[model samples]
Target: MNRATVSSSLPSSPSRRSFLGLGLGAGAALALAACGSSKGASGGTGTGSSVLKWGWALPTSWDPVFSSAGWDVHTLSLVYAGLTKLDPHGAAVPALASAWKYNADGTRVTFTLRPGLKFSDGAALDATAVKKSLDRGRTDPKSLVAPQLTSVKAVSAPDPTTVVIDLTHADYQLPNLLAGKTGMVVNPAAFTTNAAGLASKPAGSGPFTLTSYTQNAKAVLRRNPTYWDAAAIKLSGVEVYPLPDASTVVAALQSGQYNVAQIPGSQVEAAKAAGLEVQVIPSMVVATLDVNSSKAPFDNPKVVEALKYAIDREALLKTQAFGHGEVSYQPFPKGYAGYDPNSANLFPYDPDKAKELLAQAGHAGGLDVTLTTAVAQGEPEQIQAQLKKVGINAKIEVIPQAQFTQIIYIQHDRQVAVDQFAGRDSAVQAFQVLFGEEGLMNPGRTTPPELTAAVDKVTRTPLDSPDYPTVLQAATATAVRSTPNVFLYTVPRILARTKSVSALPEFTVVQRFEGVSVG
Candidate 1:
């Protein structure tokens, strides 16, 4: 990249004082104060008047891997360019690499770099840079998603414009893999020295450059005059504020402090009532009740099935999501690939069946289990209430979001935990996330032999091959029928933005800043 000195300071959370220093200027300050009072203010008149003020819960992190954090992915989309971009429908589209072709055997893929492309720091974005970025990702210990490149034997830069990637196996989903957010191209020089250096100050060929970042408080993104697609750029700058409180975020959006902010399920109506443009996008996220199969009261298949039967997903969705979510029966959310609509539903809210199953498993009067959940999501409270109705003594243990990964995904100490994991667009990606040998969502603790076999067959076969669909179906069926997780609902990402903002494309996560304009 820029060959700048890498900072060793770990990314500190942004403080409120740092938020004010990010410089929203006089106009932005006024807008922030007046936004709540003036429901639908007219667009500003100045040529450079468009400075979009956005808000979210957390500050941007340094992780380049997509699977690491959702905040990182959202920030990378604004500052870094990926080899291939995923369209709204999760289809691949060209980004830094103009076009690419795969060999008939699907073992080799060649990409042609867009001529004259340069990083924000004026570093040339050539084949060598691409190779370096990919190589670093392949070797990075923090990169869980990049290791999936086990099939990628080597990456080469035969010419300045031509980059070739050789695969160990014929992977038909190579293009889809490239479309992942972690696949963002980096400046090799910047990335190689102190790989975590880019986390605080990222250098890429994106439309915006990181001007300043203060953890939890605010982040300032300045327009890149040297951006390859500068002509398409509309905003002069963007100020992102991290407001964890849903009420605060909604108030900021109404008060004009934020041009766009996440609106909680309960506050969607409030924003709409204030004349704010509310966008509800169908998210590929599942709010599921996971059973820790490694522990007692759940190790027995009948007990797990009993818990699944006891849950009333429709009621939970209505109460917890405020009737904004759709019921989900499998790991794959609706509209995702390999999601079979006709599969037999595992649990149909039959309390009597749940009782029978519990008794059959030698627990006639119900079982006592600790249910752990992240408090902010509202699923845990609702689930605990439901379980109580079925005579299960459930206690709710709330953990902070920052600690959830370690507590649930890594530790596996709890008997039951609720998963708010976002579903992957590709069936293979979804499968890997839920049932892969080292998947985070494998609450079953023990990966069943049948599930492992099915996943292996699908992973080895080409996605386009006729056997691919059958294998995927079998794997999904095995997962669903096994009842490792009780799939509940798909929650929509509700966002409130200014009416002047256009081209706010719907994303799997509600807050994508790309192509968004204020005025």
Candidate 2:
């Protein structure tokens, strides 16, 4: 069977449309879409072969429904095309679906799929396939996306190319929400035949197909000729290897074993000195101190406020991130629509103020607390030292990184801990995960009524509406003022690659290789 036959004559995508008009669309829809190793770079095919050898962590699971790690969203995207993809600006654009529109009041959204699309296995990727994938996302007991799809009342397929999503309330954020794992469509037949096997084998109509995979080690992919916009794909294939150790990245790149890798901020100078092209891309990652407000000490609002003021964000940025990031006051990055400028100095570093607040909270003699962490090297130690000056003694407790979330997030057995937040696809989604009552980061499972109201307003506003930014910023302010978390800094994703590599873009802070080339 010839793979090219699936989309031998599909036309180019339609033009950009506003959220109020034909719906959310961007330039050349379905366009643009990493990681890691010490393996031979370029697969011995030379630079012109367009094969990317990347040093990055591999996904925990290929199937989006079963993948528990939010960080895996970008890696999984290489094999599964979501209904909507994000633009460089993090706006929702077309990918699998050519165009989409919402009805009056925004309760329902209709997506029109590109015609004659096929999975790598030659299965039709039509509206029915989308319905099946979305239904499973909300109904499957093992699905990690069920929580994100609660607003989705039902999904209906009216025709081969048409899919209508019925929402429980006005939700203009669905397009952005679908730009991540929740929107990735999988081959129904593959999961039906062997659901458990999907952890290794993925069947999707994406830009690439899984040619070979080794769990936690390596994954090789070949470009799918049947992809809707195959002509836009410049790379013949992509090879990824898990290179978690930051110290090894520069050596791997300089040794010609890896052409592209996510190096740590500390390695930035080393990579540049080695003549490697380094891209310090602004990211949504926030290194934060999560305070469980339900627990003693923090249960008192003054205590939480004191902890906030005690954090020296500038010092943390220089020490932990090596001055490669900005001091952050909220979950959203600066210049993003959801970021609030007024909150930039919300909690100025004031040890005296923190001490006064502590006394006001009835801890006049100083307080003792536990600072749990998965990695106890850089920031955790700095944080512990800073708090001591403000009369807060923090005992460092280390836990395995793998079990940190389960213990702190799920089990709610933590008082305060250092954690990294990988931002979500949508601003609203980020707020829900960071501040919602049941948000994974909210160990205490509490949400202030004002914060909830502000976030809800963001959902009701259209993505293209002039009022959207204000609504999102309003929500950010609410969360900043009431949330029980101290955001320390925003770390940029430092990508070290050979000069030959170019066009590597990031959407929603996830590195994309689509339209990228090696030579």
Candidate 3:
């Protein structure tokens, strides 16, 4: 979900920018596939108008709970209001719910909604609606946001203005979790029809309403003047283009056809040189080579251990990041609270050790292993060359990230893959999704139950407890030892907008357009 929410298993597409950047795939393929032409398009690119044209990749779905693509959240959030919103720093902030209070032990939590809030469809957004949305997400097995609320026993409304959530375990981070897509309020009217039926017809209480939405096409949103928090939004309308290629997004920004653009870091200087305003937004993404433990070669712990010393993370980060990132030696980034400062030293760059381990594991000359990545993302040739040095023949296979998701996550047929494990506002969110049980959208290879249980124990540990950091760091190392994922590097998040555009505030992940205004 890398909003980071959602898994790679969603109905496919792409997000997390820089896809079609320097040395990457061409953008015309994505641009041509989209509804070609028309700055005249209704998203308000009209002459001398008070409208904001936001350009980025399309969404998986409009259903707030069902939506997983990260880029979609930026625009969709403008149309749907969560109980609370996660700030750029990942802190929970007031939104639809003005204030909240928790019981002494944290088992029971109550939220107080801002007065007189109404959905885009004219339905009152009361405590009952909050309960409906939460219960639906908690019960839906496929809901990406459900795992965070696994401890919730019931969602009840004690009164019209107050909603109470009863948790079986004491969860201090429930407020932060609720501030995500799962806790986003949705109208029961649209949901009553069918789950998939709410794809394009999402009913919400935000600054905008969905006038139109087409898969792989542009989404048109009109201003909701009646919105409770609509004072700062001066735009008459907003049009979001789901352009896949990074080049296309840059082109849109440069051409003055798009007011706001989510540009890749590779093109920051280029976009800036083109006179586009670049917002250097810091983001988190852990590039890793996951060795499917369920399969051969990787099944041997020594062979998996050998990989830790094989690749040069610093060199890889330099090549991939263009000097914009640092090596990610642990499962979680250093910015994460529980990150072990010593994990980077766990496996230093030692090709000799890597070779010896491989030979000891009975792969003397190294066995042939396949590495899969998106067409533009995985410099498969570079990796293929690097693996050759260690006598490990790594064959490269490149495909679209969307197809990559379908194969690795949905089909679960991948043997070894070079994947990007996105950073989450909550550190446990990424761990639970990537390494937990298969049911929680563990897109990576299945780990042993012991690993899962140990990781789950960390999630249950109170964040404030003294043992919290120890448990958190231990679980990460334990999982890494399982050889499911080889820590790679972290990349920066970037965004670009026209100079004329106003109020484009930055967030770690684009959660919402709180005070965005367009000239």
Candidate 4:
């Protein structure tokens, strides 16, 4: 990692100032002006023509360990490289490390560094660097990845190229998370505790180096000449602009002020009409209507069971997600290990059954509650309508994304929240997040006895052992029947890029920026 002093300033380049003046002046003369000439496919014919103009939201913090501000992990991926990376098929592929192997018990894993690999600053990317990066991820108090590595005992380097990750217990999900933002390696020499010092210049081994960045505004990156995979490198530079508004992003894509951007699903058609390409991938995210199990009107088992029977998962998918999402009744999605289809479809929509259960629970007339959500796009109204049919009155409460955790968890003011979380490769990851001892929605922050024992058994059962599948299925089924959360659906990942971009691969977690070309 380059630990040298960073340049405080840089020369100016082209600007799209008019795009900033967008306002909803329907009756005034504040209409947006015409867009400027397009940057041709052939690197604009010169002058950093190979620069890929990419625009998206900027992360709140520049610190890699604590910068998990929504989907901003994609931005960090461009500046820092991980040990393992996900392929289009969700399989682990080598990045900084060439090859890796695991022990028979799945308690220890070893990785071999790719020879001749160097950071942007000409620093060695050997086993020592790998150990430091993994240690930071596992031990950093503020690190988001630390929770995922709770089972990891230590990260060590035996030789120059050999790196080892020792686990206290078996974990199949650790490697995949290491291949993602959780595993993004930062050069220790270039790193600073201060956010600005680190953001001023990120000395990573990625395809590009951060030249300049303004919080929530723009970032300019120059190519890293020492990139290991030359064939994957296409753009000489990558410029990122953060326009928070969805309407604004769509407008920029339509007018050609920006080459590639991620737009909402509703705006997919608009982008396609403007001659841009679109790809809708199924993201590993699941939404749920969380209930305060320890609170009144919900503490009763009948109430929880009734809430499960009341929701119309399929209808919610079609009405809210533009029919691009799939129904998710369990914590983990289908095709993942420990997933049980029988559990996923356990609760069907039966308004009569829901009413009967409520009556039996001593709430025959109805119960009034609040459904808090960050999304205001008719989701609240739709849910309000659905619950009303089951004799429950649901009021909508709109909260900002940042304030949701504080209000729901700390303050305990939000009785019910329509929230979502990322699903991992192993079903245990999802189960632990929603029902484990320290889970978000678990009552009193304590795991249910049945769920706890089931998860424990799964961890003890080796992956290759015949009992592994049986124990995993039991855990998933128990959690599903418990109904700690009313599993709803997983939203589709929708992105819009210019037609000039020849290759854009699908993403299971975060969007990938590698192997992209302007021509």
Question: Which number leads on TM-score?
Answer: 2
In model 4, the clashing pairs are 43-49
Each model's number of backbone clashes? 13, 8, 4, 1
RMSD of 4: 9.7
By lDDT, the candidates rank as 2, 4, 1, 3
Higher-ranked by TM-score: 1 or 3: 1
Task: Name model 1 segments beyond 4 Å from true.
Answer: 1-47, 376-378, 460-474, 509-515
Q: What is the per-residue lDDT of model 1 for residues 1-519, given as tens digits with 9 covering 90 to 100? A: 111111112121100000100111122111111111111221122125477887764333444652355434555667777676655645455667777776766678788777888887788888989888887778777765675677889999999988899988766565556655547777877766756656566767777766766655777776665565666666777777765477676677767888888777788888888888888887666777767788898889988888888898888888777888788777655554456666646578898888888889998877789988766446777777777777789888887766776777678788888766565535566666676656676655577788777766665665445565567777788878864677888777777887887747775532455556687
Indicate the TM-score of model 3: 0.83
Q: Worst ten-residue run, lDDT, model 3?
A: 14-23
Question: Cα lDDT for residue 396, model 1?
Answer: 84
Tens digits of lDDT, candidate 4, 1-519: 011111112221110000001111122111212122223211322323466677665654445666544355667777778777665545455677776667766788787777888886678888888788778777877775577678889989999888888989766555456766567777777653443355445656877667666554577766665666645666767778775367677678767667777676667777778788888876666778877777768878898888888899888888777777788887655654566767867888988999999999999999998788877757778888989999989888897766666667556666677877665433455566577766545433556788888887876554444565677778888888865578888776777877777667666656666567777
CA-RMSD of model 1: 9.4
For model 3, the local distance difference test gives 0.66
Q: Which stretches of model 3 miss by more than 4 angstroms?
A: 1-49, 68-71, 141-144, 376-378, 439-458, 461-478, 481-483
Per-model CA lDDT versus the true structure? 0.66, 0.79, 0.66, 0.67
Compute each candidate's TM-score over C-alphas.
0.85, 0.90, 0.83, 0.83
How far out, in Å, is residue 333 in model 3? 3.4
- Badly placed stretches (over 4 Å) of model 2 are 1-48, 506-508
C-alpha lDDT (0 to 100) for residue 340 of candidate 2: 89
